[model samples]
Target: MIGVLTSSMAIVSAGGLLFALGEPFIYQVTVMPFIALAIGVDDVYVMLGAWQDTRRTLAPEKRMALALEEAG
Candidate 1:
């Protein structure tokens, strides 16, 4: 999903920046990005499920807000 990919990219970019600043890419550094990606994907699924459960009678904006609320 877009959200998962973007979050993974951000994490990778941060790690890359740290590497540019002389930080070594240790074993832990490699593992963290995958953990973050997994968490992000899980969150996306939760949000999507919340969106599906929202009332159709509500306006689109309201439904989105409600989904976010439930997801949060």
Candidate 2:
């Protein structure tokens, strides 16, 4: 999923920055917070995607069922 891809890119970028030289101890401390945030964001995106898929799958049948009830 795009969320997974974006999360991976974020992690890789963080690692790359850490090793690129001139990095400070404060930067190392920040990684944990950034990782936590990234994971939380990814979870939200995944949940939203699942909710959208469920809605898409159910909406048409629900509408059709309503229509049939009205007709009968």
In model 2, pairs of residues that clash are: none
For model 2, the superposed segments whose C-alpha errors exceed 4 Å read 1-27, 56-72
Model 1: residues with Cα > 4 Å off, grouped in runs = none
Overall lDDT per candidate, in order of appearance: 0.88, 0.62
Per-residue lDDT of candidate 2, residues 1-72 (tens digit): 665577667777876887797665664575675675678576766555555444345676675565444433
Q: lDDT score of model 2?
A: 0.62
Worst 10 residues of 1 by lDDT: 23-32
Query: At residue 30, what lDDT does model 1 achieve?
Result: 69
For every candidate structure, what is the RMSD over all alpha carbons to the true structure, in angstroms?
Answer: 1.4, 10.6
The TM-score of candidate 2 is 0.38
